[model samples]
Target: MVFEYAPAPESRSAVDIAPSYGLFVDGEFTEAAGGRTFTTVSPSTEEVLSEVALGGAEDVDRAVRAAGRAFEKWSALPGRERAKYLFRIARILQERSRELAVLETLDNGKPIRETRDVDLPQVAAHFFYYAGWADKLEHAGFGPDPRPLGVAGQVIPWNFPLLMLAWKVAPALAAGNTVVLKPAETTPLSALFFADVCRRAGLPRGVVNIVTGAGETGAELVAHPGVAKVAFTGSTGVGRSIARSVAGTDKKLTLELGGKGANIVFDDAPVDQAVEGIVNGIFFNQGHVCCAGSRLLVQESVHDEVLDALRRRMELLRVGDPLDKNTDIGAVNSAEQLERIRSLADAGEAEGAQRWAPACELPERGYWFAPTLFTGVTQAHRIAREEVFGPVLSVLTFRTPDEAVAKANNTPYGLSAGVWTEKGSRILWMADRLRAGVVWANTFNKFDPTSPFGGYKESGFGREGGRHGLEAYLDV
Candidate 1:
């Protein structure tokens, strides 16, 4: 089964990158106050890609004010007219998908295949799906004459830059709210490119604004008096801070935070099929997913066979240049993220879980970690409890469905969970008992534009996709 394959690297020429980029505010690219800038590097090779203007508190203020100005007209426009603009944006996204895919791979160190197939399509679909909801808001169960929230301050993480932007912005705009978004510092280029997409769509001047910077800019944007609603997707700690900061304010808040999701497998589960779901659950996007199935709760009876199949599959995964067409796992997003993965993994080993990884050659330069698994893991083990947020799976065995539920629900996160049993009763029974917002049967990591997704407990509150997402940007 060992077959040699030729290289199939995607061309980088599809998208052009300037030496430097400025903040996108009020339909213009403006320099940062005092000309502050930061270099964004390609994680695959640690190459300096471009210097982006660093926005400060003043820039956040500027962007929020612009969004406030645009809100009056954007909200007043008929929903059908607004839908036309959203439709235009979706069409443009489809047309430029290839270029945006290549740029995303270069900037975020994700495989071009994933960027092309998964992220870009979903980004476009969110817009198209939300556009359909624009003129039909009354039937959405939000009452007959729901109103827009005026201005939304959104902050997205780097894992899936363009898609997360689409998740927040599309629904907000469809609900007639203007937005000021801050993309993660490491992967800011694609969001900047999106600003251009907005301009080409003839979206009103201040309808969508992007400020580039680190934490300070996001803090300012969320706390700005002009911003009436706040949406954020990032680490749990940061989400907590945001909740505290906006505690007594009139601003509406929605946070999509961290998770340590569990994937449960019963003795009767289909072994090969479950193996694939398990792999996709933890290894997709190098397990940068917040709701990734990082914890595996397998029945003790079939544990050995499942682990063997999973290890063999992991061995075949190609880990190298993100531009390469066949790469399954690309580079870690940054040195910081790579170190965090390593530290948590080492803790797993030190805590006495048996660590196993497929034998593979990682690239000489760049942040890389082999697909890894840990057996002999328990609820007390760090790997089993903590959100590794990398391509690492912690395997813990359970004897019964009750034990599986207990172990899965032990964590503080209640974001997502998966069940891999063939029995219809078992899937429904477990779904009810599982404390997660999303429960998948037979498959894991399946997402749709129409499904409302959010979490309980520390995983943060509110829904992001589907009709429910409109609530975040609407004033009922």
Candidate 2:
């Protein structure tokens, strides 16, 4: 006899999505300067979610100027006072988290469980954590005095819309910098909703402006003469462009870019625990995470055992509605992203790697890809070197710890890596030599507000969390 668990989806009525939205500048929602617009669709069912204003160069300039005007007064405000506003935003975020989580799932095509449990909670904690530093900046060890870097131009990607916004906005505000932020075109709703949360918290005008558009708008913001600081989180190619645009300017730039993380397992690793880590590393958020462990390096002695356990575990992962509480995998962010993942996976197969995915039926509508693994993947394989940014893992075998390090460090990205082992000495030995910014001993994809997170080389520069993150917005 077979038993099936009934589908349990979150109530959509908990959140209300507007038919249309405009650019949020100077604390007011208004039409774009050129009156252009774009449509955002729910990837789950190919349904139109909202029509939003398409911000152009003129609109970007206006938003940047507004931020510039607000910066003087905002920066002059007492640190203790700024802390109050940050604290209020944190409280309001916690109160409205459920609503925001549902909306994020709809717009971003991620499970509500992740938005609720991981993204939303961390977003609030970021604000609260930075708020505590507002009045204590002098002791943060930067110097006796540090000043805000005027208007900050921030660009965030769609994978974790609201959370990315919080990462950039909360700290900028805490450091007394006004901002003109642009959310990705596909997932702008949650950031727009965040604009309301700021208003409800009574944040000052232009203190946190959000503009919605594609690459053009972001370019204009990054190149704007009025912006003194720029923070971006997205692809590496775009980050390079922004770096060049701000080269001769006085803007302080920080970028958190792409990553191809490696999860290494030793022969002595606990089979059950390593298998779970392997799943969480590559499959979390459909593998959209920048520091996701997309490459799996297993000891040759235990390669077959790990793969067998991983395959059994993949079969148990439920992939379907983003709102379903039981769904482990959700729709890819968009047609373009899905295509990118597909193309990369195809390259893996064509390059002589063995592809394997569990026999599972995906939903009829929406963009979806099953959790997959490529065996016989070598260091030269595209799947091993490139950041697929999907629920895909490429497995490679290594005989020694030195060989594992060599394979892991071969990529241009140095964002993150994980090691699963019982011996404490081996974990430390691995951690010290790994080039990644954050190394996890027994876990992957775990984050905390108090920890500093960033990468080396092409994976981007400057950290986003902890006390170190605040320095990006300050003038030491």
Candidate 3:
């Protein structure tokens, strides 16, 4: 007889969702100039969470102007004073982390475990890490007197919304730049909530402004002449567009774009640990991560062994409501995102690759896709080449170390890559060979505020996190 586990759902009462949210400019929430709005839903239940103002070009202009007006006063403040505000924000984040986590799970459809443990902790940690840096900028090796880049425009993606906001905002603020930020339309609630945190912290008016809308709002903000710097975390296609928009302009731009990261497994790897890494690398965040290890490059000698272990592990993953603590995989962020995943998975099958998914019943009400894998995948296959941005993995085999390195680096993206082996020398060699910005040896999906994270080539440029992250917002 099978033993069934009791349901353990996190209470949504932790957060008080506002019926309607507005553009946060000049430190206050106000309706959009266009008088348009969009409804944000909880992907887990298809429940409408709230209506958010849809920002337009005029709203973006107002935000940029607000940021510009605040830049001088904010930048002139002593680093010690700036540090104090950051510390307050960090403390507030910790105090209300539970509320934010539940709200994030509701808006983004990531598992509660991740929103609580991974996303919230990182968001707070990022603020704390950068807080310390604010007072010590002169001591930082970027010469004795690096300067702030006036007003910065930032755009963050839907995946890990709060964390991405922390990543972009923390370092930018620490560097003494005022900001006009645009959170992805689908996941704007957390950012709106964060604006409240700024108010509670007594941060000065217009130091940070959040404009909620789709791509057009983001474009307007980035292209605004008042913005001295632009930082974006999104798709490569959009990154390229931002690049073009900022070309020949005075704005300093940085992009953290898409990736088809590789997780290379060798025969010498510890099977159990490697299997865990493989799962975490791809399946984490429902595989919505930009640096997610979407491609698996396994040694041909141990292919069958690794596949069997992976299949067994995949079977154990529970897929359900984001609020359920036991859920390993949650609902996709939206109907559009679910459709994208479906189309890509279909392409994987059409290209003659063998597709597999564990026997798991999905909830009929909301957007869902099972954890999937495509074997017998070649480089030419669309699934292997494109960013699926879902809980999907493409398996490819390599005969030798040289072959593994070649296959891993063949893609246009070089955001991140992982190597799993017990041998120290081989790990070092593989790390040295991979063109990715971040390399993981015998580990996957591990992140820290001190570590620099970004990509190379078509994955787009610029790093976030650590001391390196400060450079993008500062004027040397």
Model 2 regions more than 4 Å off: none
* lDDT of the candidates, in the order given: 0.94, 0.93, 0.94
| lDDT (10s digit) by residue, model 2, range 2-115 | 877699999999999989999999999999989999999998888999999999999998898888888989999999999999999999999999999999999999998899
Task: Give the better candidate number (1 or 3) by lDDT.
Answer: 3
> 1-476, model 1: which lDDT tens digit per residue?
87887899999889999999999999999999858999999999999999999999889988889999999999999999999999999999999999999999999998898999999999999999999999999888888899998899999999999999999999999999999999999999999999999999999999999999999889988889998999999999999999999999999999999999999999899998999999999999999999999999999999998888888888888888989999999989999999999999999999999999988898999889888999998889888877888999999999989999999999999999999998999999999999999999999998899999999998999999999999888888
In model 1, where do residues sit more than 4 Å from their true spots?
none
After aligning candidate 3 to the native by TM-score, how far in Å is the CA of 173 from where it should be?
Answer: 0.8
If scored against the real structure, what TM-score would every candidate get?
0.99, 0.99, 0.99
**Runs off by more than 4 Å, candidate 3:** none
What is the C-alpha lDDT profile of model 3 across 136-199, one tens digit per residue? 8877778899999998999999998999999999999999999898999899999999999999
Candidate 1 similarity to native, TM-score: 0.99
For candidate 1, the per-residue lDDT at 407 reads 92
